[model samples]
Target: MRPKITLALNSLLVLAFFLLLWQVLTVLLHVPAYILPGPIAVAAVVGSRFSSLAASFWITTQAAAIGLAASILVGIAISLIFAQWRWLRRLLYPYTILLQTVPIVAIAPLILMWMGSGIGSVAFIAFIVCLAPIIANTTQGLISVEENLVHLFHMHNATPAQVLFKLRLPHAMPSLFVGIRISSGIAVIGAIVGELFAGSSRVGQGGLGYSITYANAQLETNYLFALVLAATVLGFLFFFLGIFLEWYFLHQWHESRRAESGN
Candidate 1:
């Protein structure tokens, strides 16, 4: 089948399956809107609160963007440091894994309490959540460089900086994208967690977390669903943006992209 047709069919299948399950639950379980609002109700709420939702979304997106950028810069720097020092890598690797496994939810409130809430807290949380994936992936990419290639560079009297820039960095592009994709999802979770703990009462900040809190307090299930759907869409957008960037950069020469092209 043509790619477009295959994609369309898959999308339709997914939508149909979800709709079917939602309708069944709504009808058979007699689930109240308070407990689980139907998709239609959620969509309606989304439409009605588009303006307010859009503002909240913008705030969250800004926070995520700042944090992800910081992650990329810091992760790359840390990776390069480790790549240059094998012993340092060995010493730090276990601690890196420990950081990734630590629960962000548990730490978020502490972050807020320390930072005194607002954008600083949210951005810090997002950075903490997103940084690990990039650091790990970048380190893998740097170390994965071929021994023969390194020897060739050395024989050519290449400086360490030259070798890193001309060889390892280029080779690491695929792994970099992998880290970026993982960081995208983590950034969204970080932002939401941050909002849960550090949301502002002032206008023009905070996001789905605050919306959900307000709607729940007011017993507006539909509105709560709307906020949640907004968050889900934001997460999906981050994931798909990473995918598109990966394809755009790697499609010319990468093995995965080449396979797709051949098909």
Candidate 2:
């Protein structure tokens, strides 16, 4: 209870301080509203257009969800492949690095060309962006299963699938959850990036990305800020969801989170 209260208070204080600074900057610089609208102005724009913004948010969320699911499937499959075949891990490890280093900005255009416009392209981009972390972490977990445990299972005549399901998957839970937490935010970013490259299918209905682009074109600084705020909120929600899941999973019997929970 005390920690939760402290966290809530800290969050409020930070938000208040930032809002104050923004308001002050707007006045001191005599900043044109087109360049940097004050927080109040941005709030007003968000309040007025919230309904339309919500619709775009729904589209963005759908893309993020689909992408995240795909990432999990691909990640687990790749992890299993690498775990079973040491030779393949050695061969494809470099390629994994290549994928990570290629830069999402450069790849988005190619994805757009291949998948065309609409949710498919966006989801594909998000999946690609989030795939590496899951693969790497889950592979580490799957491979990190205790040798003694494996020997014990083998002595019992346990099959590979049985050992994996009973022992390896349990051992992998911590690392896999870490990957999940990291991938959630990445998925959101990929979705937004995909939207930027592909643009919105319909007018008056794009994700936050479209709103930002539209705001820039019309020199509507407040609207731009509002759109950015929406995106930030979206990312925060994803991160928080990951945190909640981790708590739900790890708090039960895990030492680290159990200690944190004072259980």
Among these predicted structures, which one has the highest lDDT? 1
Lowest lDDT sum, 10 consecutive residues, model 2, at 254-263
Clashes of 1: 0
| Cα distance off (Å), candidate 1, residue 58 | 1.2
For candidate 1, write residues 1-263 as lDDT tens digits. 59889999999999999988997889789999888888887888888888998988888887887888899899999998888889999999778886689898898888888888787778788999898999999999999999999999999999999889899888988999999999998798798888877576574456767666777888999888788888888999999888898899998889976785667
Candidate 2 root-mean-square deviation in Å: 1.8
Query: With candidate 2 superimposed using the best TM-score fit, by how many Å does residue 186's alpha carbon deviate from the native?
Result: 1.1
Candidate 2 lDDT, 110-201, residue by residue in tens: 88888787888898888988888888898899999888999999999998888877888778878887888899998889899988877576
The reply for model 1, stretches above 4 Å from the true place, is 1-7, 20-30, 201-205, 260-263
Estimated TM-score for each candidate: 0.91, 0.93
